[model samples]
Target chain A: MKRHLLAVSTAALLAACASAPVVEHSKMTGAEIAQIDAVLKRDFRAKGQAKMTRLEPDAVQRECNLHADNPPDSVARSLQEAQLKTIKYPSDSLLGDWKNGRKIAESGRGMQWNEKPANPGGGGCYNCHQLSPQQTSHGTLGPSLKGFGKTRGYGPDMQRYAYGKIYNAKAYSACSHMPRFGHSGSLSEQQIKDLVAYLLDPKSPVNQ
Target chain B: MLVSGRSVLLTAALTLAAGSAAAQSQFEKYQKMVAEGSPVELFELVGEGLWKKPQGPKNASLEQCDLGLGAGVLQGAYARLPRYFRDVDRVMDLETRMLHCMMTLQGRSLEEATKRLFGNADKPSEMEYLSAYVAGQSRGHAMAPGQSHPREQAAYELGRKLYFYRTGLWDFSCASCHGEEGKRIRMSELPVLYKPEAARPLIATWPAYRVSNSTFKTMQWRINNCFRQMRTPEPVFGSEVVNAMNMFLTVTAQGEPYRGPGTKR
Candidate 1:
């Protein structure tokens, strides 16, 4: 088992820690950043959907860079506040099909330079969070979100929560690691509403 | 727990190869530039400051915030997580534990806490920075997340069962990519969760700093993202399933040195 092997390595790593010549990659300096950026600009070419702008950081990214991601408290609050304004709550009070939502969440084929512009994109949720009772093929960058409706309750409040969270995680957490799905139009309002239904509908597999 | 597997490493290698090969030379150059200075350092600094700052509802700092290592102590606690919490009566990881602290000490509502499970601004929820800071403390310390409690043990077992349970259009499980090794996709390496050796190095590294985003990533976010990729529904925050997966991962990591809040490509 992997756990057993890890135990052995831990012991060995510790045993050799004392006199093991430490070898770690050296960090890049500011000059390196500029030099690399130059090479990147020269080598990068624009493509469909995935454009040259993909490399460009928006305002928040620029601030994160200027402040090294730990923006001043006031700055962080303001940035987050600014981000919160970007969320658009649906007026239709809709919940699209969960069955369809499931398909959207599972698909990871989109956004690549080669992806056709006409191709509908995938949400790639499983790459970061656990979602189903049966699925094993998943990632852990984000938290497991099983039993979403059971835990959060299938109320309008919960519905809004799902919509907002998926719409723009940063609006809630200014520096959230989650991509701004709807805010950036990576997903559509209709799609986000379906995801909400997927998480909050009692009959949805998430609750079932 | 349903998400555990060795595919991460394989995926990483494949992603690495594909990304390296498919990515234009400029993209690689940009990645190299981005990798510079390891933006995690900033979050680490923020976390260090938050560690001792006293500002909770109890008018207390997280200085006494016990991350399962007795009160006010945080040395080498990273790799020993996903343990039982008497308060919640469940196993919690670093982010969940911090949520409890923020609630009990800082008087935050569950809504206020989970409101930003992903991460946010000035209120930069303690999850990411705190997790990064905590993991950083135990950097190089061997992980020994002892699942001595009955619940901890149960969570691990349940997580294992979930890991192998498969259903979907693809009939895929966590084992699909992770069960195998040396498989890759784009420009990343998949650490084999089934292999403790693979899981150990990473279990504690989360709440990691991402160069692309220049921000800290929490375990919850990581878990949530996986579900997104699986095309499954998102897991609720602080749910049993999330904690079980945490326990499973932590259990497998039972002796790998914790080195996190570390830089990730």
Candidate 2:
């Protein structure tokens, strides 16, 4: 039945492609993206913390959208370099308490319109990446961080990498799906350092 | 087809639960139990009453309202919706068309009609009940939304682009979670909605009764909540983006038998 459904839709899509007077590529054109932007501006109203400005894509986002999230290597590298400059490294230790990190990792709340601006938001780490061996409900969207410290040695360089990655994931991968926690002000320096400890601390369950 | 349908559903369920067979089966068992005792029929009955009830300025029922079929036709009407309406000169989904009916046939103002578009467990809205009733009327009919119309084609194109168009604080698009198969967000498997196989069962059972929230949800509400989660501004109800996304999903799953207003976790 699944195969039947697949065949039917494939045939339909093919027919649609064949019958078109002008062959249009599946990639989004600039005008169409602009049209979508226009529609969003016209159709979406500001609610709670979600402002009309959220509709506007940043430079990295614009390039990602134009290239379908697979920008050219040179462009992506340059974008990554530009993004790296945005992260603010704390002058002190990169790692914070992992116990606090556990709470942040478990939480999936933050930056949503329903949330209050004054209240501290969660890292929502468990929503995408597995951390400890105990939490089986973790998501598979990101690579698992179980035994993270064990696999990658618990060095200062690793801690710095973890902190920077958590701060702005796009600094490493230009079109990454992960949010820019520090850059976007979703997670503070302390919150990011705590998350770094959650992954890299020897005593953390992630290393167990 | 019914036997095959059940198997297809099972296959999809098991595919989602690839790593944990035991947990998946237990979840499936819970789902079956929930479906058995669903209050969907109650919502449908209430909807029927609302459909027949006389209200608004004209004080006329929705019986005269045409749902892309001739006036008063109910059977199989939903299966072919989000279609282009000649009278309105737009591609409208079920809720959109129903809103048009409330204004035209019953002479209700747009503000009055859409005041409580979404409802909670304690009190489901008129739109929720009405969607259940109308969608139930198309149970066995093949899912066939509009595609031939130039506007519909444009909507589909827009929807396709929107799926991959990453924006917002999280830089998340629909593709962030749903672009890949065999991925999940905290145990809930994200369906790769662009794929026909993934979309078939998912799209077939929409405007569903959500057990977790104890609320009946429409496709429009579904899209609305997703954007909210994406940390973006709220989309106006029944807008082109919402309808266009619906168009993309429905068109992708065309020819699947309508098996909802369904039960969901």
Predicted structure with the largest lDDT when compared to the true one: 2
lDDT per residue for candidate 2 within B1-265, as digits (tens), equals: 3332333345444544434757778677768866876788888899999999999999999988789888989987898888888897888899999999999999999999999999999989999999999989988777778788999888777777787788888899998989888998988889988887788798889989998778889999999999988888998898888988888878877777789989998
Question: What DockQ does model 2 achieve?
Answer: 0.46
Tens digit per residue, CA lDDT, model 1, B63-172: 77788888777887666677888877878877778778878876767876676666653445566777767778877676666467898887776566445433222223
Compose the digit string of candidate 2's lDDT tens values, residues A1-208.
Answer: 9997996686466434432122122456788778888988988999888888888978888888888788889999999999999989999999999999999999888888888988888988998998898888888999998999999999999998899899999999999999899998889999998989999999999999
lDDT of 1 at A175: 49
State residue B163's C-alpha deviation in candidate 2, in Å.
Answer: 0.9
Q: What is candidate 1's TM-score against the reference?
A: 0.52
What's the C-alpha lDDT at position B119 in model 1? 61
Model 2 deviation from native, Cα RMSD in Å? 6.0
Candidate 1 lDDT over A44-110, as tens digits, reads: 4454454554544455544543444456788788887887788998888858888888888888775
Scored by DockQ, the top model is: 2
- Candidate 2's clash total is 0
Q: Give the TM-score of candidate 2.
A: 0.90
